[model samples]
Target: MNAYSGHTYKFTKEDNTFSYIKVHIKTQIGVKNLTRQEAVKLAGEDPDYLVDDLFNAIENGNYPVWNVFVQVMSPEQAEKYKWNIFDMTKVWPHKDFPLRQIGRLTLNRNPQNYFTDIEQAAFSPSTMVPGWAPSADPMLQARMFSYPDAARYRLGVNYQQLPTNRASVPVYCPFERDGFMNFSDNYGADPNYVGSTLLPTTFKTTKQGRTFSTLTEHEKWAGEVSSFTTEIGHQDFEQAAGLWAVLGRDPGHQDRFIGNIADHLSSVTYPRLRVMVYELFSRVNKDLGARIQTATEALIA
Candidate 1:
């Protein structure tokens, strides 16, 4: 299966400039999908079929690898783009930005202890290195805070101290201390704030003499606070309609797409709800809405 970082991010420079980016992780072995019928059958037979397949493949020395590529768009290009660059619904078309191969990921080892390795694992967009950071996409901004906060609630506040989640690079933040399940000595009685004359802290600086502050100039743009609204319109469905057209290239894929939706839409049990769904699809394409309605009605009948 292929993976994408749907959210927009930034590849930043020490000068506080950045290029907006999206990540793609494509499997070396081409994507293959089981039909809905086959998927349903396999799900009932063995729920862990995919996981077992992956584990056995790795164990048998067939390490599955994914080539990591990034699509980068300059701020000027972003400004001139037809669609909102920050909109997660929209994608930077290949012809416009193009993919650049950067790295590869290989799943070579299975977990030694599932509990320590998998269960305790935590991830957040806010956990970024020096050169890479998140864009100001509203959804991305919300996720940066929400994901870590959720982990803190589920695991103890000191969940980051866990071996699986701990940062590989040394981090010193004396201000943040005395949390639940704290592994460290809570900074060992150091002053609990930055710029303390008693215990001065060193801030990493780039060769350009810019201190490594989380706040970038792009983020700290000179602007007064203002209310914003993301109003949905016909433009919102343009990319979805484009995807539907792309599916037309593959035989039965479009029909399967409609059937997949119809299966669930037919089970909604509310006429108004089903009608709303059809109307939503109508925004994408009139034919798609009619096709879905007919298929779903047939299934119900």
Candidate 2:
């Protein structure tokens, strides 16, 4: 499967100038998909099919590789773009902003210890390098806060101190000390207060008089500053309709998709709820919605 960074991120310079970018990781082996029937069979017979496949490939030295590309959008371009750059649901068209190859990622080795390496592993979008930063995407902003909070809850307050999650570079934040399972030196007699000249600690300083990029006047005025509400409109179904049109280009794809939807939808006992589901898809495509309703009713009958 092709991996995409749905959220836009900023690539900042030491001077605080930044470019917004979306990352794409395309598999070198190409994309392959199984039919619904095949997927169902494999799900029952070999529930761990995908994980086992990757592990075996790495064990046998047949490493899987993915080519990484980034679509960079300058701040000026972002301001004038047709679509909002910070919208997570929208994508920057390649025709307008082509992909630039940055690097390759290879799965060369498997985890030695599942519990220590895999189970204890904590992943958060907030755990980024100096040059990388998050954009104003609503979902991304929420995830940046929520994911780290989840990791703290799951692995304890000192989760960052765990071997698997610890940063390779030395971190010296004396303020964050003496939590449960804290096995570090605990900053050894250094005063926990900031700007303590008595201990003489060195901290990274930002470039003198370098101003970071700020939101434009239009962005600040246009962006919402209220609680999220479930407001539906015609524009909400535009992307789904586009995807349905794409599936139409592939032979039997649309039919299979409808069949898959019908199968699950038939299981819903509440008639009113089933009608609501059909209505939601109808907003995407009228014909597809009708087909799904027919197929689902036949199955239920």
Q: Could you tell me the lDDT of residue 24 within candidate 1?
A: 99
- Among these predicted structures, which one has the highest TM-score? 1
The residue pairs found clashing in candidate 2 are: none
lDDT of 1 at 169: 73
Instruction: Give a tens-digit lDDT track for model 2, residues 1-301.
Output: 8999999888877655778899999999998888778989999999899999999999999999999999999878877786667777677878889999999999999999989999999999978766677777777889999999999899999999888999998876777888899888988886768675666544542345443433333345235531343777787677789889989997988999999999999999999999998998999999988999999999999
Worst 10 residues of 2 by lDDT: 213-222
TM-score of 1: 0.89
Residues 152-258 of candidate 1: C-alpha lDDT, one tens digit per residue:
99898899899999888778776568876898777786666757476645665344556554455655331221124478877778889999999999899999999
Q: Which stretches of candidate 2 lie over 4 Å from their true place?
A: 196-231
Predictions in order: lDDT: 0.84, 0.83
